[model samples]
Target: MKQIINTKFAKNIFLSALALFSTVTIMAQEEDTSSKFSLSGSIDAYYRTTFKDGGDATTATPTSFANQTGFALGMANLIGTYEMGKTGVVVDLVFGPRGTEATFNNDILNGVINQAYAYWNVSDKTTLTVGRFNTWVGYEVIAPAANFNYSVSYLFSNGPFSHLGAKADFALSDDVSLMLAITNPWDTNDISASGTYAVGGQLGVYGQFLNAYYDGGGQGGLGFEIDYTGGFDISEDFFFGINAAYNSNSETDSGFYGAAIYPQFTTSESFAIGLRGEYFAATQDGFDDVPVTALTLTGSFTKENLILKPEIRLDSFGSDNEPFLNSNGEATNSLSSFALAAIYSF
Candidate 1:
């Protein structure tokens, strides 16, 4: 019996050694065929102040982020990507005041993580991704380096930010694509306390996308939203972009609708100008609608990896509401502000 036990133990050890050898060999082969890992990110800062009769920074800006008075820190973004064979992973981290606000719904354990996801290319036409990712419904993203404007629009500010879910993307043809996702309720990053999930779909064709998201009713739930985002290039240096969205909550019978247009012209390789004109409104059950119009003009100047943007914005509200305080500390119907932002990307 002792000899038999000794022989069995030897066999087990040999099998383990063989398994380790096989794993190492496979890993080496994969490394040889994989693409190089990449690291990239950006840092940003800005100074903002209201003009004329507009109040301080906190009251003058009704939207989100970059609202602090005077000089302020934006955020530090760092993204690392690794691809091996048909699988890839992206780990994006953000730090600073802007990052804190953007990840307000994130899990306490992973506070600074903006996005962490893994994707698999199942075939030439299909890919599957899982984990936390930025929302696909809006025209603007959370990263400052990616947006042409320094401040966010009302439509992008009010919409969902990021989602934790699993998604499948399919390339229908050269010009058409489709994506479907199942996720926790809007902005519910870690887990759903209400034990509910949301569904999202996107249809893309010729640089245009139609997006839809629906969540049954739960904490931080966005009942349903239908959005259209697209852009067109009229000339070598001229471009036009548009975004329209409608959101509703069947449980409360309240919602909002808005539309915005973006027209940009490039004057030189290092300088460009753009404008954002938006009309937004909000409604509630048994209440009159509140309407507002905002116009923003921004100029972009670039030198190497650094970008500087000088922007001016005006927000006007319908006579029904006075949400701003003027220079004399009196309620007013409009507000105006100016902002200068600097961003460095690599």
Candidate 2:
């Protein structure tokens, strides 16, 4: 069950984290080597047009790149980090529509922060982190530069985006690692979320040509989700990745599940092309089952710190589901869109 957040308790936690950060900074100041600080981020903008302009692109995929017929701002992201011996802090800030929806339901200070977390090195191979951070699940991320496609997948749209918690990461060996975390109920980017905490973890294995990971977690007041992501380098210029996920909410009797595969080919240092095919389904207590299948093809051309992505996507609804609006404003089972996006990173 969800509980009301205690203002005093939340304030105390924030103050404590601030105090710890200050203490570590002071201690590191006395050391011969001064603490290191870095600032980096990216800016993104895109233009998208749907084949059927009457039906908004936002109706097709509920995440970013939802512009219907013209140009739009994707987001501006800024990340700063401070690190010293055994301790560090990260402050990630984002502004724009994409940033706002990344943590839509929970807003602190009217939606300015993406993540503010502190970390400690417990040992050579162990580390602990506290405060809010991004979720370990999902193949795609909020950052446009990190994704191959301009549009997001349904799995990414519906899955948890970030978490508020404390987590520890351990490197067991050269090829294996693990992470364990206890966080405020799922999707709560705000630190003040109350009620029972959720437990989650990730286990990973890395090999010369292949990498695989499994992550899962749940909140008592909400539900649970499990995800698997794997990738293989088929050749020097070719690669493939697959992802699968399942989530269920006990309180609402609703479930969401999906799978996707991504394939890419890089012919040169300046150009690459990729495709993403996904199928997703949703089931609820009293509503008609909704299922979506989509295919996206994207090409990237890069020079220096700038990259350009041109993409096209097609989507279709399940036979039993209600259709989306077509160009003429008539209900239709399929929709298509074209997008061009540019990103500059530093």
**Local distance difference test, per candidate?**
0.84, 0.75
Give the winner by lDDT: 1
The sequence of per-residue lDDT tens digits that candidate 2 reaches over residues 12-57 is: 6645755775676456545635579999999998898777654554
lDDT by residue for model 1 (14-52), tens: 346445544654564576675669999999999998855
Q: For residue 63, what is the lDDT in candidate 1?
A: 83
What TM-score would every model get versus the actual structure?
0.88, 0.85
Off by over 4 Å in 1: 1-35, 54-58, 105-110, 286-288
Worst 10 residues of 1 by lDDT: 1-10
Model 2 local distance difference test score:
0.75
